[model samples]
Target chain A: MALTNHPSETPNLSFLKEKALQLRRLMLVQAAGKGQGYLGQGLGLAEFLATLYHYELRYDRDNPEWEDRDRFFLSTGHYSIALWAVLADIGYVSKESLPTYGADESPLEMSTIEGRVPGVEMTGGSLGHGLGIAVGAALGYRLSKRDARVFVEVSDGELQEGSTWEAATAANAFGLDNLVAFVDCNGIQADGAMVVPIEPVADKWRAFGWDVIEIDGNALDQVVGAMHWARMARGRPKVVVMRTKPGKGIARLEAREKAHFIRVGADEWDVIAKELEAENA
Target chain B: MLKGRTLGMGELERIEDRPFRTAPFAAGTLAAATRCDRLAVLTADLGKYTDVHPFRDAHPDRFFNVGMAEQALVSVAAGLAKTGWTAYCTTYGAFATRRAHDFLAIACAHGGAAVKMFAGNPGLTTGYGGTHQAIEDLALMRAIPDVTVIDPCDATEMQQIAEQAIDIPGTVYCRLLRGNVPVVLDPATYRFEVGKATRFGEGGDVGFVSTGFMTERCLDAARKLETQGVRASVLHVGTIKPFDAAAVAEFAGSVTRLVTAENHVLVGGLTSLVLDAMQEAQILRPMLKIGIPDRFIECGSVPYLQDKYGLTAARVHERVAAWLDRSGTSAAA
Candidate 1:
């Protein structure tokens, strides 16, 4: 309880709740601008991204490349809608440029390219690379003798990649306590309904020598609590298996059969935006 | 009471009539690390084969062994480079390219990470067949934009690249010739430079442009050709990607015809580079490629494979003499 980072100091639940809604609204705006996107996954990840950007992560808002700043590596690059929305909220990205997402000659590519975007530590989207990069960055922190941590966001579907396990093995072998992985267990993938089986996910991570913290990812309290638990954990890396619902905030989007990518018609953008606002209101 | 067994080693063959240096990579790296404050060496359980054990013993805190995961090995190095550490990684060329190519392509190549990959057993150097050999490493690595590709001739060039490649920006992939490597090039006369080719011998009839340990073979073939009144010149191309196009074109212009050789496939290795260089330089020269064919190589001893694949110096000399006789070109002409 005595560890003094932003997570403990900013125990204001209401602020984080507002930030989560705001992230959803901004994500809707970005997706609506492009007329379509991986809106379902982005909507589901709003709560976690809100928790990370507003509470857990430590970064200089003025300088994204600050050497000692805590990093938040978005492993699934298709989830750039969520990152764009959150960083825009943090003022790291200009809110006016939100419409240019996924457009031609846009810095806001559907997938992240590291230096092109600020606040993005690694260019993700090629599944199974985030954990290893986070582990290396954590080791770099130790080598440089800094206290800044490395936080990574991965999906349950990404576990199917063998390289992810290789990274998981190395993370435990190196004993990277400064690294925390948040796996979004959203139950669906590109080929529909998680084609490969990754059940007993918590047990697998536990066997891989990590402190496992499972939580209902849409719930802000549990997300914050898991962050606190991971912050206090010592001597081993941590994995917070976040069981999230795709397209969580809006009912119409959630009820759709294909929630992996929410391709809404142009006329439906206003309705979805209003629905998102009404849910929080 | 333990039973000893021979470790299945790759590419332990050495060139004759030259001074040998033990673990020149380690010696060269130690010297480089002395000057740089933030240099670290890493390997994926192949530390014994890579000769990084000496560096590991000297600076234990700076060494990392990330099990046998090649993808993780390259990804971790890219991550380390992102955080301001020049990471040096060593692994079999097969695993480094075939297995971890995506990691290297996206993580290191796209981001411009300052990681150095010392790929061992490149082309047909390994006796472990296709599974362990890196047959098309030159073509694969050279295609990746902004990455420096190198294949040193011997111990002298290997040691020099080890020191110089530290300061080379972005990423680098070099064919590692280690464990009592032959000293074909004299450091006093031959200096290794990035994207620079060095020429040897006084013969102007046949120009042999070669890379890797095949440079030694070319020099030997040149000596063999010289005794038969056919003077031949040998051009050693150390760096393959930032290729010495100007040197290759100039060398092509000077000689009557060209013989491009490497320990790799002729499709996209040194032969491709020379063709590209001549095209840009607009110099048309009759070129003969002496190297591995486009197919899967079989498992055999190093000498047997070298002789079978036409990579030996005698085979190269025989091929060049035959080509000259067919073309009706000699030293008298």
Candidate 2:
């Protein structure tokens, strides 16, 4: 109903790239205090999130809960490692709370809890619920004639959850073009590899009547371009399947055999930090 | 207090050709939506079955049918709440709890979403066998943190709850009685208050703490008890969570004995809550719990199932008389 599909001027690609590097750095700093976390997924999602928070989403840091603002849902709550980093960078949460992540009584929980942070629209971690919630929000927004878009980030591992398909079916049934689902296909799960086969991810979404786009998630330009295309209200929900390496920025972490949960040696913090900085430079 | 034009498992013993409110859930929810502009009614493909067709027909723009996906039904309601819509959804109680328990837990209740869920076929109200009978829905819904659990007793309470549950903060899971429902309480004198119980008659001999439409049976049992010289009082506890413990304790303290009856299992239901309340008050009164036993119930007519499971008024009265005689307590009027 509210169709503003015009493409905007090019976003500063270099700036977005540097912001991705900063996100990776902050992720390491948060993981360093605990020495163990969901770092691999966090590292892989830096560019995807950086492009989203820094450029794509229309939100106000001053009024994080501005009712009509674009909403971002984190379906993979374990990626709070990346969410906290991005929110902190955007001033929604304090940078000082980064070290306390995954700590007891911390607002920045290991997973995304809705009430803990104002920016977190939903409590995620118990997989396969965010997309449906997004669908509801998109429907409500459209009903009220609000043009703000709903963006939700999920994972390939989460695709195995049956509720995900249920939500997928409903979104297409409602013809919710205002909703966009980013499937962060990192190809790893808590039990090493995917316990269930969720291959042909884009085709699966297409089967559900979604407008599908498959891209290299780490590529910032592609992320922006995909978002640009997703802006058009094409009378169907959209999904972007982003195939990304588990650990993208650094070679040592990227080459790890099992990267679901990363635990660094107490002495390896400085080395990993240098690896990230050197690669970006 | 008898209803007419009944069908299926809703048939009662005293059915007569009298006026009755048909589809009270649909009528009440439609009325509530008319007043609240922010209200949206959705059903998981059980619109007519769950008696939500009135809301669907009256407010077409505000109604959404999400096929038969119970999980999405709940999550989408929660999501709708996030975007500032009070979503009142309906489905079979069995599916709302057993199928979408996780969605209700993490997505709806955890976030304190304004998703008012109406569960049709509460307890043994359905003849659709184990899969459709939501016998443990009250217990399952009550266990969720910050959830308002309600069991409306009749057409009056069903209509009242639809108007009231929206104002109840956080999420609400109400057990609804739909289709040719009996009106037990007078709407003029009764108001559906959360965390409160309604007392029928001030008899001091025996007080029955009951909920759901089982209160109707308890009322009938009380009248039968009166003829046998036992003055029986019925305390209708509609809200299971944020339970009216004070009322239970007060009612327990006054009566010589207590009887907690419901259409659900004995465990974690009204009986368990009554015991907890009495225990908390440190009152060691002899109590009788009348309800279904632990097992999957088979498909049958309401009267047959109620008779088989000892939930009918005749069974309730017989059980109480036995309890009184065995205890050697004088059930004086």
Candidate 3:
């Protein structure tokens, strides 16, 4: 009964775009401040987070624990920097929180602090977990006859975990139409590309009885369109394969594996700041 | 004990009046009633064995049997949890502990996925041999930081604890059994409370703290000891994760000798928990462990293995007496 379907009035797209840029800036700064972070992963996932928090997700910014709101699970915990940037940009936490990325004492431990991070539905770090939790949440909503959707952000490498497929099989079997999974198919994992290749990802999802869609994740409109279609799909759960570029906005990091782990020197902070400002301009 | 409940296989077949039982099945029912929208029932081709078939039948749209893949069983449950579903994945205890530990620990527990696992044939309940027995489940689950562990005494406790599991914030791995479960504790005498030990008998000579199916045999041993004018205390501990060291230590400090009984390996589970508690509380009494040794048990009858492993009432009585004699404590007359 605590679950609700009271949708909020749509916000302006211009504002969301600005928020995305700000999030990118925050993430870049956090990575630079730490001298190292999962900058590449966060960059790749920035647009997905932007589209979710800004336009698609049903959440109460002021009251993160609102029972009826959509549950967003980030299964790959290394992308905490990206998630932190999104949370800060969307006012889930203050922008000031960004400086503490990878700090020893901060509550932000470089892992997605599920439930603790205002909009994060579950804690994530260990891969292959979100799908089950999201499955449970979707079932909870369905049992209550609520229309709230559950969205899980899974990485390409995470699919190697048998648990993700387990959830996928069950989601289809259960006809969880309200559940959606956003896969960041950036190709790169901890050690080079995922083994055995994860291409034709959409085909695999469709074979598992899901309503699958593929989109260029960096494009805001495409991301939004996929979300719209996913919401409209009936019966089967939806999976949006987001093809993204690692280290998206930063030109230098975009091509380097260093984007995967960019460690900025203390003396190079000024140079990095200047470059970020130029990119923003 | 509750009887005459049938175990249904899938959507197609139904077995009649078999007296099905398990903690997760009972908990699944309560969860089904409470989180009606977000709750889902899942099994790894083990709907009847783990006793989740009832929930599946009631909520067909919300129930799924994901074939016989144990790793997939928990992962899919974790995925459902990710997508806003509170999924209960059930399977045999042996499969859960040995096969899908990564899913149970990382995906469900460490990932903070709200997935519940109901493992069947926990610690010698199956009588089906080593392949089915879950002697190391508690040890496997104990390593996860945020996961909750439960071992119900019988059908009544199973039913009550099932409802209580929803209150636990993260992944829960519960020992389960199905069909014709016996009632070990009176409903009026003991209430279902996770993390709290239930003291069934009072005594000062020796105390037996146990978990899983072995608790039932230990209680019987306590009764047998009483008939011989020996007052032995019996404590049933169902929750093993946040192992209640303080309570175990207090009981150990008061008793002349201590013993731990479980249907699991003595290296981990009840015996290990008791030793850990004693070490932490600094109460090192002459402790005797009554359970399977650190070796795979050969296929045999349930009673035979119980006797072979010293898990029967007679063995418990004999072991407690031996320990008492060594400790120079006389039986209460």
Candidate 4:
């Protein structure tokens, strides 16, 4: 399907960068409210989420389940903070609902649960599930002759699952050109730094018959450019290996040893908020 | 159609003795596919074995062979279901229930996606050992909320159940009796309901409640018990989850004794389900369970396994007769 609102005008790179910063600030605020969360991955994924929601993806804020809408599946479901920030910013979710994240009986769960919340395509957190679903959605769309595309955001650690490779093989075998996968290579997992190395990640995807694009994910220009390039690639599924900083735009959080899960004090949150305000100014 | 390559009269006669149970499944799916354009069939490279080949042949555009990734097979079906399509996925019972259970639970059942999973070679139907057998599939699938679990008794029920499964709102895990299935139930008067038990015969001494292929054995056992002057009733409980508690309680209340038969393990299967239902209903009776014990079954032919696991009709009759004698209900006949 042709993109409904393709940025015919040259995208204002500076505007998107500001949006990315805003998303990161919102993610930090949400995590701070919960006392702890998957803050690092959320922070790292801010730029891509911001770029996709604002400048790239074809979606209706009012109609999240529109038949022809481009699907953005958060394969790394723990990065709900990042997705929530984008959704709230795009006005798909109420900005007031951001503080209720991770609370009991709240729609804003610590991990993404699809069907419960609007704009969330599928439930994630059990890694390696999203891409396979994306492949299916892509196939479903193709069968229905709908031009809708499916984009899945997977993490570097999620590659360890054999199912991920299985999905990669199927996507290529089916020639799902409408499917795009973003591997968030943030370099950390629940058990600390990745114990098993999955280096030469692009080679693995390329060998599996996917169109691989490696880039510094934190860079707004590269993130936007790669997305455009992916949309044009035909006859193969696309993967953008996003090398991102664990905690971007925050000095203290970035320097923490255990960056996978983060816990911040009430006092530290205030300091972080002030720092973010200064950066914005 | 070459005459030389065709099967001889004796071979043809042998083929008639062994009914292809999966034939009805393929025919039913093909019939459903013709009516519903949104229906899709997926397999983990077991389409031919599971008899989804007919659907694949009839509707090539809507069929998917996921090439042996059971997890992908399930999750992909979920994805297809999410897009407002009814997805029917097939694989071996062991692989579908054991390997991709999490995907079935989280993706399909949790969201109440319209995905039907047909699992072939249930329990001792395959001689490929413990790795291939799905003795615990019932317990596992039953634990998942919003999943409709069905174990059809024979080929006729298999087709009817497959046709009915498409209309069931959420995910369904059906235990398929694949190749050479026996014809036990008559379709003329037998209507398959989702959660209702079908009572085939009537007696007062013992209630022989069974599920799956064991239901066929129970009917046979009941007939044999009649010859021995032991009156026995036969109740086939096809749907495991959303169990027919009222029917079971009614049957238990009518009989002086109860005997449960199944192809699965005695624990957490038909026996456990019946016991739990009877206990809840306060219909207490001396119960004897005839099924695979709490252990892995050895690799063997179907007849050997059936005999070893005490799943044969004669064994059911023997166990029920013994239970009647021990409980002092033998004279109730």
Q: Score the docking of each candidate (DockQ).
A: 0.73, 0.85, 0.33, 0.70
Instruction: Write the residue-wise lDDT of candidate 1 on B1-333 in tens digits.
Output: 112322235544655656788888988899889988688899999999988999999899889999999999988888888778988999998999999988888888888998899999877776678888788989999989889999988989989889877899999998887788888888798789899899897578899999998899899888978877898999999999899999999999999889999999887999998999899999998889988999989876677788889988888888888899899865232
Docking category for candidate 4? medium
Kindly report which residue stretches of model 3 are placed more than 4 angstroms away from their true locations once superposed: A1-17, A269-281, B1-41, B57-66, B69-89, B99-116, B127-130, B163-171, B200-203, B226-231, B241-247, B279-284, B318-333
How should the candidates be ordered by lDDT, best one leading? Answer: 2, 1, 4, 3
Model 1 local distance difference test score? 0.87
Per-residue CA lDDT of candidate 2, range B182-207, in tens? 88888789988899998998887888
Runs of candidate 2 exceeding 4 Å displacement: A1-7, B1-14, B17-19, B329-333
Runs of candidate 1 exceeding 4 Å displacement: A1-5, B1-8, B330-333
Q: Would you list the clashing residue pairs of candidate 4?
A: A1-A147, B19-B180
Question: If both were scored by lDDT, which would come out higher, candidate 2 or candidate 3?
Answer: 2
| Model 1 CA lDDT for position B252 | 93
Pick by DockQ: which candidate is best?
Answer: 2
Expressed as tens digits, the lDDT of each residue in A92-121 for candidate 1 is 799888888888998888888888878877
Q: If scored against the real structure, what TM-score would every candidate get?
A: 0.96, 0.96, 0.84, 0.95
Query: Which CAPRI category fits model 2?
Result: high
Best lDDT among the predictions, by candidate number: 2
User: How many clashes show up in model 2?
Assistant: 0
- State the lDDT of candidate 4 residue by residue for B76-124, as single tens digits: 8888887778899999889999999888998789889888999987887
Interface RMSD, all candidates in order, equals: 0.8, 0.6, 4.0, 1.0
C-alpha root-mean-square deviation, each candidate: 3.2, 3.0, 5.6, 4.0
